[model samples]
Target: MIDLHAHSTRSDGRLTPGALVARAAEAGVTTFALTDHDTIDGLDEARTAANTHDITFIDGVEVSVTWQRRTLHVVGLAFDRGNAALTEGLATLQQVRRDRAKRIAAKIEKLGVADAWSRAQALAAAGQITRPHFARLLIEDGVCRNNNQAFKKHLRPGRDAHVTVEWASLDDAVAWIQGAGGIAVLAHPFGYGFSAAWRRRALAAFAQAGGDALEICTGTTDRQQEITAARDAAQHGLAGSAGSDFHAPEQFWLGLGRLRALPGGLPAVWHDPRFPGADAAN
Candidate 1:
């Protein structure tokens, strides 16, 4: 199986990097990428574990991008993790995420929650603090039942705990990925709740800004959406990529490489020989 997007405790995920790779291997994921949110701290560990488990490990990261004042994710695949430009770009995002987490915790505190920031810190440990950590806090407080409910009730935009933070522009993010010798893919377009026309505009802009691919098969996308995404990506001259976007085992809607085949007749982002095991994955 080919799974180009996944997370680890290096970001908001539940498992550690090594454990994440082991889990994916158990799930029959042959080609995998550790696309941790805004950080590559887990890549080295995940790569080591992938080697041990005889899995194809792709160096990847999920960048947070603000396009038209809305936060979206861009997946950087087969990148040079040591590339200075990519590392520096991700560093800035790391700080932005930390600040956002603190702001969210402050808001939660204002709602009479005690020691919100410290408790969130304890939950995160050395990992990057994210909204999921906050969601766990909400779950613990009995404010919500799960991550989805936490978002719907309080953490999502237009909610009490939501604090908007400026993220990297789409152009800057795509540039950084390209600089790292990576392909930039728009991740899970349908997950953003954009109408068809709006999605087209976003795909057009992404392709115009040098994005190379868009995810067609993903945990959040259905069969019809996959077909539409493939058609849209072809129209925009972008390739089709697929991934599970797996974060945690408890996430009911996500799994390791559980996506269907990429829509036929579309270019694949990993067709290039530079990405190891590309032939086998196809």
Candidate 2:
């Protein structure tokens, strides 16, 4: 099985790159992508572990993009990590993330969370600082019962700790991915919380910007949703991609390589020339 989206300690994920790859290998994933949020720092370690386990590793990154004033993720797969355009773009995003983290910490501190910034930094452990780290710290301090509660009470949009930062534009993100010899896939469209018309407009904008695929299955058991995504992909002349979007081991519903297969007659993202057996029919 192939999993085109995942994370590690390079971002907010719980596992180190090596451990994440090991888990993917153990889960019978023949091909895996380490699409860490806004950073490719974990790719080297993941590649080494995948090599050791005889798994095909795809170089990838999940870029945060601002589309129609909303935050969305665009996954770039099979990219040249050394490409200057992609590297520079990611550096810019990382700086924005750092600033956003500081703002979030400040806002949460005003709400009576002592040493919030320090706690989040400590939790991150030299990895990228993310909202999840803050959420985890809140949970540990008994401010919230779990990650979901933490987000609901503080981190989600319009909440106290929600710091809005402008991310790269969709066109720029897609261009950076394409410039780096990668195909851009709109990650988990259904997760965007947009109306059907807005979703269509977003997809059209993405396709116009040179995006190559849409995620048809993202570890959800909803067969109807999966089929609808596939139909949308076909309608837009885009290939279909699947991923678990796995972050932590406790998220059993999103286990690696265990996602439902893409619907019949949909073009698989792996059919791209960068992957082996690309010539084979999907």
Model 1 Cα shift for residue 190 (angstroms):
0.5
179-246 per-residue lDDT for model 1 (tens digits): 98888999999988888788888888899898999999998788998998899988988888998888
RMSD in order of candidates: 1.2, 1.4
Residue 24 Cα positional deviation in candidate 1, in Å, after optimal superposition: 0.7
Top-scoring candidate (lDDT): 2
TM agreement with the true structure for every prediction: 0.96, 0.97
How far in Å is the alpha carbon of 282 misplaced in model 2? 7.3
Candidates' C-alpha lDDT: 0.89, 0.90
Off by over 4 Å in 2: 280-282
